[model samples]
Target chain A: MTTASAEKTAENGAGEEGYNFAYLDEQTKRMIRRCILKAVAVPGYQVPFGGREMPLPYGWGTGGMQVTASIIGHDDTLKVIDQGADDTTNAVNIRRFFARTAAVDTTEVTAEASIVQTRHRVPEDPMTEGQILVYQVPQPEPLRKLEPREIECRKMHAYKEYGLMQVSLYEDIARFGEIATSYSYPVMVNDRYLMSPTPIPKFDNPKMHDFPALQLFGAGREKRIYAIPPFTKVKSLDFDDHPFEVQQWEENCALCGAEDTFLDEVILDDRGGKMYVCSDSHYCARRRAEGHRGTLSDSAAAAYAAAVGAADRPSEDGESAEWVT
Target chain B: MAAMATLAGSAPGGIDTTDLKPGLADPVHDSQRVFRALLEAMARPGRPLQLEEGLDPPFPLDPATAAAVLTLCDHDTPLWIDWIADTPPVRAYFSFHCGCPLVERSQQAAFGLVSDAENMPRLGLFAQGLDKYPDRSATLVLQVPSLSEGLAVQLSGPGIDGRETLRAAGLPDWFWNDWRLNAAQFPLGVDIIMTSGRALVGLPRSIAAEG
Candidate 1:
């Protein structure tokens, strides 16, 4: 759909010549490319850039979209996921957005994609050197909580100051007995620039350090873009007594019976009935296809089918899945 | 991550200013260029930089300097302010234009506006990068009261060939002494910018103060 329109725009001989390959205009792409180059040069350094407004909202993966849009060309394959599910509405919409704008090929398999825009979790599969991961950061400043002022933070960055961050962590331990921030925690990138991993779980934080893929962050409403180039080091802010830890689940996935994947706990009934499922849809599906089965696969499938049936049944306003479980 | 679908919905490179938010309508492009100039100024210290046109704010901050912050800061980057000039209009302008969060404490800011040099906090209170890596220093955007002929001080440091004197205004002697100590930290000191309307001067982390 996007290909047709892009071709139409091209055929119409839009604006000046030497514009960018897609519609990003050469200067914009050049600026983004320059930032990417700097990010690559200084791995894990959050090189700030002038972020532009996309035809989308702020929180909904605009950063990843911008990075992807800047890097993508007609030949590249794109993959987008949200909560590890490609079929999820946001993922589908983002995929559609890129398809329409850049006119690039879209894929679901992680390995095949040249660029992947992700929210929450990194893929279970290992990322390669060629790929780039663009994260959607809600907040980019790590010292934001410790120091609220941009002027102060800039002074901090300029002066190489970070004592307050340590003080805040110590206070957190003194009060809560643990660092209260569960996800989207601050990690020092390349031991220099402070970066926000965009609310991805702690499980994904380790994956960020020493990763082969180039990592980029964009916060549209905030108008900031930072990056972690390939091979950069990333470390979660922690102390000797308080080591960084991923979320641990006592039970295996109810769908794929996998113990390693992140699990989503579901309450089956008011009487403490419960089930757990692998949050990575692709991984879960692959496991099920490979003869892996869990205690509730059959029942869950039935329940899902019943829910779909109920939705398909026309109601007063023709709404479907309005109240999803 | 998924690749973009196609090239259909991509808007033109530049949006119409009339269509843009009032704060953002006219300045995105020029703001970007000027911000780049500021970055370049820091990347190589002591270099005088020129700003693009179309930026003018009220007293306290020079237009070019204000333009630099407007380009980089948003509601996300908090400002540590030393003094308040037209509070309502300034706040409204920043919120509407840049959407930058304002911070009262100097230590917590990403950028700071030091209106009064006499009342400026100790430089050590701001961020200095950690031991292993030290480029984490802060960037100070100082608005000096005046920049006149022969009102200068000598500078010496990494970026300078030798002793170089440049004119500046409204900074205390303690500020320079502290800056020298800050520069002794090498890759861990703050960068400074002193500006009037169209003209501006920079002192990157590399510059050391000389008597």
Candidate 2:
């Protein structure tokens, strides 16, 4: 074939053979970058842009991936997590995707990553300066639940008319004796606009306040991006009498004995046997490596140990290789 | 061939275009650095950020403004240049390098360049963007004499913890009055970037500016 035909064929087969650097063209990146700058300029204000459809589905972290792609360089280390576990299927898929497309290093450790894309949880570890946390948002507007009309929500945000949100919270209190918003709790950004902190549980809401790392939220389906610069104030919406509170658990992690971390309840069988473990897999594993034993029975601990050992094995393709325990 | 050579040889006013300078040497990396600096400047309003200096645009264009224009503007962005910078050579340079169309009306521009801040178009002249998407508003990049040697103005808003004092010269006395009117609109106002030498300070619409 001639050189021209070969180039045409390559262009035709771009997706299967090779993707653009980080899977986004430079023009698209520039557009998103402009939106990001504006979002940073006006904290908690959602800046709309032309959100591109990624190779993955819309609900599957396409937003976070795009933000990561725009900001990531060849030298950056990326980490992806779903519900705070690095070994989940979605996290592994995203990690593998970036590994192939961008050729950047991937890590499971929270502190080692320069960029962390998360779906529903912020890592328990404190992020240092220069690190960026990208959250995949399903809904960018905090008032969407109350007002379905986009125009009305815009006006409400414009005139600082947040009475509907307060009424909703008051109604929740009247019904359940507490604010019923467990995840995706609304928070005020820089004391200006009310923002939804994605779907992270209320337990992680405190981490968004005065955070050292810059936080960027992208909603691909909604075609919006917003930001909270480092050290910006974020206050969860609440009344003085009914202050904000996180979920409290009576049991520590069954595997790592970490009482401070967010815990996930796991059922052993059809019987009444149950256990609580850290939702963050890396945090649990690091504690286990540090020889922090928990309340797991002997056989359960041994079985968990074997599973972790298998997960640490080296593989031929490094993309699917076991995550660091 | 003669016509083509003439078109390329010199712009209007007999300014030779043979030795035209380059924009950021490495477009991708350099633009990323510039964007980072711009992001910081916008996030922390009233704080001066020193930008990397390499661009060599013609006279009347400050280094910071030029760097910002080159980094942010593309064919997609419509640019509006003030009277002082609406020259043929500068227009040719922008059209050739950035590919952004020069607009006559400030309201239509995605980015506006002001060479003379004292005579700049009124804040109401530019697009304040729609209420739904206020980010669509134009970002005004004003070239000033110096950032540190101006009248001290107090700014208080989202980025500022309490209030910040900044010295920005080269603006009309009525600018602060206009800014107050602009801030009253909240989510709907033109954001300003003051450039002097290689430094820039952002004044986002959320800020309350008072002398």
Candidate 3:
């Protein structure tokens, strides 16, 4: 049989012979594929699905992984990040899994990747039309607080019954001087459906509007998936009296000296030594390559390399087998 | 429309357990099918849903709806039972089947299941949705002994263009009164589904309770 026919045969069956490509069955992929098309058509609308269990836990990046697995093909280049760092433990593990199963090419640069699975931050590079950003969402509902029932939420979406959401925001203005939401601020997608940008800082909210890339939000535990297609209109919810604003810290990324990037506060030692760093690891790495270095990067990288090198080293007998835990 | 393709045969008509997706074990697959049917019934208010099989549930709740609770609830989901009205067998079965913990009060439950609506707690007891995003609300599953045609309540809302009435037997008079107040909490109040041994009817928060 030709290679193409063999590949097609494997695609029709789950884990047939030697393939478990991404560990999801083709039927499940077909289901997710259907959901994606509907999401793209409705743009910014949430569609409920029978989300399956992965080998990984729910809180971890399972949702994003599922989305990646569904859309990832032989030709795709994948990139995964946690807290914006590609080398972070969770990110490393996910990338390694994809490499083993799907044998897809991996990239560290944002612009080079066709599919990027991310948590917490959007990349500094403006995404082009061909790229897809899959977000790991813990909570997918924008109106979960008002109507706990999935049945009710469906009705609200059908009729555009959203008065209760308005009341909650008005209350926020009443209590705080402004809308107190910083991270995970709710936004209206395409002026038709309300969506959560998956806990990305409000700084990323504006970037969501009319973006060139397709954005997919998956909340596995919540059993919901939502999307924002290329050039879709997204507006953060706010009143005329108090407009929406992104959260800004007084300090810049100490390493990059960049004020526009979202900063992650790193506490050094017990003395409460505070330093701000760019949350996006690629952005931070680029800054360092340009001769910008934070106080902690050198120490952190040295410790990390030593630990990994030791873990990878061969034993005295030259046998590569790792000891049982 | 593509998303609805796989779900078409299973939606309005109750799912056949034998025809379920391969590799799914009993209870999980059956419950999933029933839950989807229930969700569809609730999505379209005043519509009655069919049960493919009898549930033979422990006590207080029927087998069909029990299957729904088992499929939907988990450790992450919060469940509220009628005040001291639900039986021990029912509670134990839910804990075993769904792994869901009991809520101390009605307001806290993601799902509120009531066996008796006559002496039911106030509708205000359930959590209401906030103003900014009103979708966060509780789902109430009320178990009535029988379903009939007389003295039913009319439902008209997002899914229903004209008035539609559903007969749910064995409910208290004050139930509608409490539901009236619950409807006022639209985006904030609870969504209710009244179930008998074989039939189901939904009352979304969007519906206005007739006086």
Runs in model 2 lying further than 4 Å from the true structure? A1-19, A297-302, A305-318, A321-325, B1-19, B148-156, B160-177, B209-211
Native-vs-model 2 lDDT? Answer: 0.82
Clashing pairs in 2: none
Best by TM-score: 2
Cα error, residue A289 of model 3, in Å, equals: 0.5
| Separate DockQ for every predicted complex | 0.03, 0.42, 0.02
For residues A131-211, what per-residue lDDT tens digits would candidate 2 score against the true structure? 889999999999998999998998888878998999999999999999999999999997779999999999999999988
What is the Å distance of residue A51 in model 2 from its true position? 0.9
Global lDDT of model 3: 0.67
Q: What ranking emerges by lDDT with the best candidate at the front? A: 2, 3, 1
Best by lDDT: 2
DockQ, prediction 1: 0.03
TM-score of chain B of each: 0.78, 0.91, 0.80
- Candidate 1 lDDT over B117-211, as tens digits, reads 66777888776655433434455777776655535678754333445677676777687789789867655656666666666676765566666
Residues B86-193, model 3: lDDT tens digits: 555566656655557887788788788887766777777787655433444566787777666546777665444456677777777777887787766454567777
Residue B135: error of model 3 in Å? 19
Per-residue lDDT for B41-66 in model 2, tens only? 77678989998766778878987889
Model 2 interface CAPRI class: acceptable
